[model samples]
Target: MMFGSRGKARFLAAVEGLESAVRDRDAKRCTRGLREIHRAYGKAGDQEIAEGGARLAALLPELPDGPRGGLAVFVGACVERGADARRCAPAVLAGLAQALEAAEEFCERWAASGGGDFPEPDDGDPGPGVVERGGHCAAFGWWTLPQWEMAAAAMLSHVEVRKELDSIVRARLLRDLRTVTEASGHDFKCLEQVLLVLDDEPLVALDRSSGAGYALRMTGLGDTFQLHTLLADVLIGGGHLPGQAPSAREAAVCRDAPGQVPTTGSFNLVAPDGSLLWNEGTPADIPVVDGVRLLVLDPPPYRRGWPAGRFFPNMPGDLVLERVLGAEETAQWFTQVAPAKG
Candidate 1:
């Protein structure tokens, strides 16, 4: 949509206000300025948003580490508030690259200082953790990590950001992410998400019925046993499948049995036309949909001695499985299909 003269005026004013707010380090003013930009972009198209993001990216390096992170998050929030992530990805990735570089420098400096607090930069504004007690005075401290994390999470969650990365940058980012994840005790969600993107993993759909299921990013799975374990975990965790407490022998029996074994019954991975795709095999052996395997776990037989009740609650009695492919497609599926049913 073409911006009218008034809308153009509003957008430019909002951008000017945001620049002023960032320069002054005024958090409230920054937020208000962003909200104004958001309002100005109410009917803007992707091109307009992308242009706005480019304008915002120009101001990123002027801010401190904390507010740099905040601005990155605000961009993500704008995406969530109906700004297109793909359109905003260039700016987001640019900011992420900067944050990662800063974090790397901080890590090197901290290590060089023998794990003690390092001298703050001469920017007058105290860096990260410079006050409050308990070893909180450093050039970069605990305060910076969460900000970096939030920024990373916001950028890495969208697939388009990965497309914006060149090979060298992607490798550097993966390395830096590993460093940060290690420092943060290996519990980083952004790291996990990025790995999925890097490995070109598919989105796994737990198909319940026609037009209903839960979709999760596919993680590494070695074999059918691991796949079965994952399915059981997800199903039992979500209260869709009953928790099983089979006897030692029974447990062994189930475990020892070949692919896709239920606690007391049987299941199959079947195609939409009822042909068996995988009655027994590893995930790698499953059929591919758009370059990634899509497995639809057929509902377990409902029989006596087996766990009773609807295998997939709220699903139609006649189950018809469907599959979606790619990060973008699966994400779209989640937003459009799964939210209402799931």
Candidate 2:
């Protein structure tokens, strides 16, 4: 997508303004003039974006994915209300808010300078463009990659972060694994690496409790799966979303393990729609509608947050609640927890 340098500048300026609004927690004001937040997921083809894609690629540890961006009618407004560009480490994603604000400013300034708006290019796919309802717009484009989907990239990042944490306390974990292997006559791996053992399992059932958080019932769990469902019901007992999942009589809980310990409440459940459960505390699950894969493992015990006392009895750090799936089903979920799919 070729736009005059002036146009690019304007869009970036607008993004900056948007970021400011987000940091200030002013979403409404930031997106006030924007007619729609045209959230776009690119398909492919473009060099400038390919370079941006390269930076995003760094974000992936093992599998790479597509580029994503959103268009706001008042792009500037949205940035201010929804982003925290300053928080990103590499400075690109982090500067998203600023970039958007700058783009908007550049456009407004250029238009004021009598630089007549460029002729509306033909209906060229132009990759990605932010169209304003009144025939105004700030076009932006990006390409989708083949390495992995955007949702997959988020999954990989979760894995990489988990590994970084485990490396810090590797020695202690190694000793524990050795003890488990020798005493149980099982080829035990380090608690920080159970993902390798159950990569293809399906998630059958889920359970959660304020006391134990989320847990799943695996296919092999057999009757055990039902048993977990029973226990989890008792654990999170009275907590549940008002009118979703399970039903008024049954709150099925996420039944998935934790990718990471929650930040608030004792439990936060991530239902299939990403709605969330009570023990599935805090509910930050990605929108399941997009097919984002999730890895639910027991969070590291030493991790911080909550009261940090007997949150879940016998909750092993490396346990993985395998999802037991058949040829055409999501895996069967079980109570075992594993290391983050690191």
What is the C-alpha lDDT profile of model 1 across 213-282, one tens digit per residue? 4444343332343345445444444455455533333333332332223344334454433455432334
Model 2 TM-score, all chains together: 0.19
* All candidates: CA RMSD (Å): 14.8, 21.7
User: For residues 1-342, what per-residue lDDT tens digits would candidate 2 score against the true structure?
Assistant: 443554444444443444455456565645541211122212222332223233332332211111222221111122123222122222222222232333344344445545444323232322232233112222321111111112222221232322333332334434443442343233312221321212222233332221122333221111222222323343334342121112222212212232222222322324443333333121112222223333232222342233121112112112234333342233333233222332
Best-fitting candidate, scored by lDDT = 1
lDDT of 2 at 202: 29
lDDT of each: 0.49, 0.28
Question: In candidate 2, which residue ranges exceed 4 Å CA deviation?
Answer: 1-7, 32-152, 155-162, 165-342
Residue 275 CA displacement from its true place in model 1, Å: 30
- Please give the lDDT score at residue 317 for candidate 1: 14
Error of 2 at 284 (Å): 25
Supply candidate 2's per-residue lDDT for 7. 42
